[model samples]
Target: MMFKDWLKNKTTQLFFVLWLHISLLNLFFVNKRGIVFLWQNNSELNTLLTHFVTALTATLFYIAIIKIRLRLAEKKLTLGNNVFVFGSAVMLALIGFFLF
Candidate 1:
């Protein structure tokens, strides 16, 4: 199915929310441990690579969430979009700093 057409489906929209929520929860816990471990241990390229992979996943999930929400409603902006984006980004940023 085409991307925009798929987003029009309510089930697909729900899936986006589910993916976003699950990703966020996983990120919260995973990043908590990962960040702590990175800080306590000597930083290595492999370890940093793992964090980058996670960050990439979380970012993609967030983007999907935003795109689905906007496209489903056929609007430009919606309430609370900034809140979701900012909150997730901040959490990721915290994890990112420790990764490097």
Candidate 2:
């Protein structure tokens, strides 16, 4: 696919946004420098491990959101339904935040 068309895709946009969100969360909250610190320190193993964990975490979150979105899309749209989905996403994110 062309880059422009790829960027226009909902799935692509969602993935990009979620990846950026998780990355920022790690940078400011979880790691406080994160990959930069590892790079500066030249800790190859730590850097690779960090990258793997970040990508894994992002993928897990993406899957969770996508599954929830798909399930919700099957039902009639309603404010309550929207709220439930939002709440579920927040709860899942919190679980990841605390667990990690």
- The top-ranked prediction according to lDDT is 2
Q: Each candidate's TM vs. the true structure?
A: 0.35, 0.41
lDDT string, candidate 2, 5-93, tens digits: 86347555665576566445544323455544223433356744665566666666666866777677888543567887998899999
In terms of lDDT, the poorest run of 10 residues in model 1 is 35-44
Worst 10 residues of 2 by lDDT: 34-43
In model 2, residue pairs whose N, Cα or C atoms come closer than 3 Å (at least 3 residues apart or on different chains), thus clashing, are none
Error of 2 at 28 (Å): 14
Q: Write the per-residue lDDT of candidate 1 for residues 1-100, one digit (tens) a residue.
A: 7876764565455545655554444343355446422243324556545555655566667668777877968966565878879978998998899899
